[model samples]
Target: MIFPLTVDRVFADRTRAEIGRSVLTVPAPDGTHVVLGGHDSTGPEDGYPIGVYATPAGEGRAPGLADDLPAVGWLRTARPLRAAAFHPVLPLLVLGTGSYDGGYFFEGALVLLDLASGRRRDLFADDCLREVRSLQWLDAHTLRLLLAPHDDWEDRAARSEGHLVDLTRSDWRAVPARSLRPEDLCGPRVPALLPQPTPPFATPDPESPRPGHIRSLTELPDGDILLTADHALLERWSAAGDRRWSLPADPRLSGGPLAAVAADGASAWVEARGDWRRESGTFIRIALTDGTERERHTTPGPAGLLVSSGIPLLVPVPAGYGELSRSLFRHGRHAVFRDTPRAACTCDCPWDDDEECACACACPLCAGDSMDDEEVWLTVVEADPAADPTRLAFPGTERRRQICPWSWEPGETHYDGPGVWIGETDLVMATVRYDGAVRVPKQGFVTRRPIGEDPSGTPRWVFPVDRTATALDIDPSTDTVLVALSDGELIALDATTGTLRARGHVHVHGVPVIPTALTVTGPGRLLLGTSDGRVLTCRPGPG
Candidate 1:
């Protein structure tokens, strides 16, 4: 049975229709507010036409392009500006460019404009920084920059470096930085946000390596553990604690069977994800007898976030703007000529999401941008294993679907709710619980409810946990519910009563690991993957 969901409560923090845009604050040097309005559609292709203009602050005048608006000193560049600000004490302006148009994998650069003299200095130092994601003018002569690489590049590791630019000498130097695996230095989105923040103007050890921890783990009926690795590999461990089988070790993909797994008596359905270089992924029917691929089903590549339960494969459908942004990025990478809108939705809500962006203006720039013509909805996609996942659905509304609160909320430093999991006949949802503007810490809850004939009602029960659960499993034989928290803790609870049973930590290959995912793989076992690239198994106790 399919049950519908709704938003229990809503809180929004917004000023103007700001979504994919930034507000530039310039001193104006004369008390007037200097506004360099960002174009909702500007990027690498169309370029950024950043101009400085002074507007009296607190005026009711909405920000936009008007014929009467005066341009003081303007800087035109083919690169999109990620951040820009005028120097507080000097006649200089600083702009930062991110990895737009698939530029992150290679390098990112910075630009400095002498507003008074109109002299521009383009800087690309250290040969690193695929994108300068964040920038701030530390002083009249010092600029601080945060640098990062793309999400799925070279190794399983991610690096963050800080740069201090000397405006006086027109040079830059490295500063104290933190280099860790990409998983730990994550941003609000998948594949991690470029330019993870680091301490500015100071020196920290730059050597960092975020080891490939476990990605996904599930227990088999025979008490075996089936796990995936961040390096895109899969393995099976028998009940006797021996390596049963492993997939072809592809160093490039370093992927695991992350989407979902459906195990039958003698066979299993596994999501065989490939590298981003491909346009599709394959679903393999593996024989439990020897762990060989028996049957194969091919679906679109970048099926990066997949969740399945044998019958239907569920994918997290990016709301309209996200889809378009991703599409543009992909096209930009492939030189596909998106021919889409250059302006983006300034309101946090996508322009097409009328409910959220009721005040969104359908301006000429937006109209001319080809992508602005269509609407994208937030909904769960039901993909057929026999066909490509090209369809989406909404149970309650036409344009929007029920959303997980923690997923897209603005204040969320950590984003959860990536997929919809259907474990056996029970639906498991691990989400955060809030109290007003203050989020109740470690109060994340795991709500489970068996799919009943009624199709609509309250959950079976909701139990609180220490952090947002990364994985949930229901052990039918023992009637146990296993939840994995982000901090790598596993909590066992009674499925029927939702009472605390037992809690413990998981270790893989003798090292304590941060649990990435979990599943009840066998009769008396729970399987979990950690952040350090190991698949470990555990036996929980009854509390």
Candidate 2:
């Protein structure tokens, strides 16, 4: 019933290279423009595929960039681009770059280029970041940024945090992040965009019931809320908003962030994380009544544990790697170069500026056998634990279906990795992978599928559009899907037929608002966490 897959990373890269996605062109205040280039798939021999090209603004539009600006500046990086833009009115340009630790998060740099002097400096040139995910020029004097977490070992990974830079201040200093409204994105004189945060949950509460590592939120038979917090902590809350009791989080047992938690007829099944730093982890059994450890075992985990039938099922994911970044069964090692010893080779990717060539190693263990060492694949194996841990396969072919089997199809795109379950049986997915002839992760699709017996299931309907979806949530009451796009657009779609229901560029206090966290509260009501780390609650009108 599981569809295990081994994505040919190298072959995938070569395919992307052949596609050669085009660059994005944004106009400056003047007639001149800024072109943010694409990433190169072949190798880092030339540099990271990202580049910044400026064209000379003559009396009119320059006919040809190649002839006019023969020498476009290249910003070859091993990391990827999170945000790139030109200063509102200055000759300086800025970009945010980072490597994806996993999923949509990245670790990287805030690079600034002085076009007049042709000198560049990385604003956040430190080694501590995943990447600069959001960047904006509030004005010529100020810039704002939202940095991705460098690691996902704790609660910080789920929250959006940002930094403010005042050109007025010479050196970098951390400042509290301020939410943006519509006027902020389009620049001065625009009307205030987003509404204020809804009452109650809008304000901050330092001492409030802040729960981390929310592995699962379940309701007991009597209407009580059973919430599993981070570090193996569990709490029972009354429907009246009272904290009934919290179980002890013993350090001796597994106390890291839990992956999943479930309650059966008697005991609760919890997947506890280990102190991956020590390369050690364990699964522990607890007695629901006394809150005492019944039994525990050491394993290659920081895994998700559950009880199926009578046997214990443990899902060991790629741990110690950034969230959503690791493989299901890597033997604590990545694919090494075929021609070199694990010692002779840095194992670092060339794009990251490694001085060696991989000739592309494709390790089934890590999918690096052919992909760049820096590339990480998204794979999951759902099955019973094997006596010999070496045997593992994700999305196994049996009972499996290739949702979007054909890459570069005429109208379809690739699966965007993660998706949400509609109600309990259906799924809603978004992607940016079609064969539109553009090299960019352009308008993809948000599709729905009715899963029954097959894993290679086809979508019931496909909603095609010009935006790359970043997140999605379904409103059961309204029968609509809320899609968060990378470009700061919040939209609603007809859930049943895959049609557009509503669309808008949400903004607060003149700054356009996008969402990093989306939760459908009830009916037409929803909560949105902005890229700037701010929050807003609203209901989109019907189409």
Candidate 3:
């Protein structure tokens, strides 16, 4: 008997309004109720407007305007609201607003709103209020807001500047002082920002671009902080606002905005995205010492690339390619195939002695006695440092040797994942089963043998558990294998004896998590990154 499974569809209706800006829900003073920011409708048209909304105690949804709620209050603003941000721990909201006519700015002001009393207090104001880019709460009383100079006439009369305001002392200060110019903050020369003509998703829309968009900023092990931009510019800054050093992007690869950044030690692993068709998308390894660079061309349409102990692994998503073509480079440079001979030779010809047959020999090992011409051409290329690189350049000349004999029929699905170098001679490959017609439980089969061996050798399969595996990482110290599954579970397999060593469920904040990226930090520490932007460090337990 066969069983079929189906998924459910659910949808919710959301009201559309032009008055309300993007508002974030926050906890109120009572701790049970929630306070919503007032809508900010400030722009070139009318002055910025502000309104507040609230939710009932213990309720999840926001209360309607007609509902009677004692915990809710609204405050009027003097000018149109430009931008607003909620405090991390306090019931305070910071708002910015201004007025402009024909690109000429008039009055610009920053206000602080107290949710408990519905009272509005002025924070700061200037003649050149352009717009607020971002607002973040640094501490209980300290707030960081990014302000752009107004692009209006009245504001043009005054000097344009970016200011940082301190709500605790009610004071404003210029950002980066007078040393750095605004043009320096602007983005470098970039390719045309035109969207793909037929993007895989929806049509692209032009949004106001932030010139100096900060990418990843993480606190180091020490008190210092590391910051990176979209253009692969890494900067280390001291806690006291001191610039240490700035590393430039690689000019050869035309390294554009970075896609991801991971740090192991003093070195940082940066994956920058470039135009592949234009010979731009290349992965580079940068040494923080003197900004030395090494680059490698990876698989096309690579989703991400990870480095484990200096070994780079390319993760490419299958897109628009057939099944056979999709498995081309899933594992690595070397791919194994199970081949069979077409017929047996009766006569002991001289050509068959050296494992080579003439063009008209018609032996199964030669060109003619095969069932299918396409299947007869299966050849595997093994990387040999000692082999002449020039001889290996020909399509099928130097590496036209077979390793395994074709005895049994090939499996419908191919196994492709991490390549494990078990010892100096043995190289084991992990394979998984994937079928589009029927749902089959995923399993791992190991193909192990000595390097540079003939195709006559057989490979053995090793199954750790019943779960479907997505990725495999081998521990060099213990020879234990870490397998990441589709169900968000990680299992450890002992490669030497083919036994299950350990298993554990990965979670973040008590909720089950699916790891989007996984890397072995050390022999025992495994770094897991989830789709929800959470990272967890897991160490192996005692046997």
TM-score of each: 0.39, 0.39, 0.37
TM-score of 2: 0.39
- In model 2, where do residues sit more than 4 Å from their true spots? 1-221, 226-236, 245-298, 301-313, 316-368, 371-426, 431-445, 450-460, 463-473, 483-490, 503-543
Best by TM-score: 1
Ranking by TM-score: 1, 2, 3
Residue by residue across 219-321, what tens digits does model 2's lDDT show?
4556444444342345455545455665645554433322223324344544454343222246555444445555556554333443222233443343332
Model 3 Cα lDDT, one tens digit per residue, 106-165? 345566676656566664433233344445676665666555543534543233344444
Cα lDDT for residue 520, model 3? 52
Q: For candidate 2, what is the total of clashing residue pairs?
A: 43
lDDT of each: 0.44, 0.43, 0.41
Estimate the TM-score for candidate 1: 0.39
Compute the lDDT of residue 377 as modeled in candidate 2: 21
